[model samples]
Target: MDSRVFRGGRGFAYLEEQDRFLGGTQAPEMSFGFIGCGMMGQEHMRNAQLVGRASLGGVYDPAPKSVDCALEIAARAKGTTKPRVYASLEEACADPSTDALIVATPNFTHLDVMRVATRYNKAIFLEKPIATTVSDALEVCRLAANHTQPVRVGLQYRYKAVYAEAMEEVFGRQSVGRVCSVNMLEHRFPFLDKVGQWNKFNAYTGGTLIEKCCHYFDLMNLFAGGAPEQVFASGSQAVNFRNFAYDNQQADGLDQAQVVVNYDNGVIGGFSLSMFVPGAREELVVCGDAGRLHTVEQAQLGSENQNHLEVWAGESGRSRSSAPTYPSYIAKAGHHGATFYEHLAFVEDLVSGKATGPSLADAFWSVVVGAAAQTSIDKRTAIDIADVLPVTDDIQDLMLCGAGL
Candidate 1:
């Protein structure tokens, strides 16, 4: 139970030791200013309280009812204090008391949110799918890379125990030696409505892949070697909120998608998604020179078939034991308990002066590839990742990013 006090400014007051196990309910020392008090924002609110380590610095939401909703959730979660309700993100960023900020706004609003946050030197935890366009994403990266405060992109799956273990065994130890193809498949019900039903419009979500598939894209970059070189994709908005005719919501995003990527290293990575399918489940299979690793989760997996992982050591007819995943306390149905780990990891990074994150660039490129895929699907052609996204001048070297794991 070894620990150290983090002398960093306000929000990063407490830090978790690197060796600490996930789901340890130590109260966070830092105070947080949360932007966008929506469903995802409130979920993080619950996690911050559950950690018992974080306190509220302030909270921002444009809608009057939304602010009330978020405050109600915080109270229900038994958060230490009801934070100040800020009228705008700019207001939250300028406050000296606010140590760190968590940006959980919609896809379209991210650039504006980050632009405000960068004005201050506070540590930041920004949500995934940096922006709707490759250029906007690059600008956000440039701002963060140049800012003095530490920043982490919210690709929480990287913090999950299953992924950590898999990464170590396969890439770190070379158990699955050189990975050739990393494939992912997700079949589930159609996208549900968010507050204001903003997600139904491309103007708000930057298309379905950027809105939802960013996590999978981040993972694909992680396991499939590095930045993708080119992509070929196909999908249609044939179902869900639009074409299904069950609902009146007008939408123009893909309900089913398949993206094939060729990495610079010649490793091919692919992701298949179907929102209209029955029985929610996701399967990720990675094959290498040695053998392969496969993982499956029954959407919620519930109490019965909880998420599981399997590893095959080599091609010599050997297999590693497959079983239910570990770190269950933090492995809630929402994100396989990844929420808890992400909070802890961010806190640890803040306190310890160490940050191995879904780096800003790492986050940017996931959208970059996805945006390109959308282009490929629409135009019926193969698109190169490097061509669509250009290198920035001096503020940020785009090459140094996009490769971060």
Candidate 2:
């Protein structure tokens, strides 16, 4: 097992040299095939190119226009060879040279794409949430477990340095002095305006909570350091888009919602989400007895764009001493999106046999908690995570793996 690390401006590339690429010759570029050529798909392609030593094998999208878009983007980017366009996923997956596949399709189609890729024995980069329901998500996980290669889900926030540092400080060092409660607020434009009607429907996106707030729920679980014991939430379409005009309205989706969760370790978690806010703020404020930590808010950029972290410790009966400001790289100057960094990490893990971020099971359970929050809102009751789905040893093990990865 030969391991060599390559350092570049973007980040470190850990490569494991193998017999397949010996003989005093360089290995062929890793070939990647993408299933969907939508916004996220294009970003993945660009990132793979930027990371270098990777090739675009083929791109498949149901929409011919999306194929054209992918081809055009590939033409403009450096280090990207011409990519073959396929009308169906089968054609893309059938390419023998395609080393791995990325699935960025609609929510309901994740399982189908993953199942096919697993059958082909290919590594996978799937966007979250893994599935709309717990049963389907679990089945996907089962299929992944049977696969010969790694199955990585795109939860890029886990890859950010700030989040990593914060987790180490809060959980590892116990700097937070037993997290008492967490208050989180995420504001953005509506889902329908951005993702169309499918996202607005309950059948497709699994309502706003499951589709959108799963990230926060996952983060809450990470900070609380355990599975939530209970959840109570209340929400409504208080600002229906149909009643408002685009000129005066912010977005067309859920206006406001709030959820309160209780962790098994006695930590309380509070979350508020709104699509009507004037601007975006994906910020988290973590308060502990020793100090409070705030994640710096910045715009999304290429793979490197990330939020900064600042911590303040209570001293002399008052808060004093602030953590130093970390650098922020939220967006790249060009059209390339931020998801590419995450996609490259997925590919790097596959080649080097490293554990990938956000496993399928972790993404699945995030949706589970999000679904439970919706249940609480609809029933006007406090929903326990176990009540919705029994907290088995499997869930706990999955959480541990997710946190460390």
Highest-lDDT candidate = 1
Model 1: how far residue 150 lies from native, Å = 1.1
Per-candidate TM vs. native?
Answer: 0.87, 0.80
lDDT of every model, 2 decimals: 0.77, 0.69
**For residues 1-405, what per-residue lDDT tens digits would candidate 2 score against the true structure?**
322222223232234335233222233368888998777787777667655556888999877777888898789854357888876778887788888898888777888888777878677888777787766776777677778877888766665545656777677766667687777788765654433445655667766787778777878877876668888988888755656444343333355789898888888989988776554667777888888877755443222334566667667134333332222222341221335457556766877888756666668767888888888887899987777764567556555664432
Residue pairs clashing, model 1:
11-30, 27-52, 27-53, 28-53, 28-54, 330-337, 331-337, 332-337
Could you tell me which 10 consecutive residues in candidate 2 have the lowest summed lDDT?
1-10
Score residue 167 of candidate 2 by CA lDDT: 76
Whose TM-score is greatest here? Answer: 1
How well does candidate 1 score on lDDT at residue 106?
Answer: 86
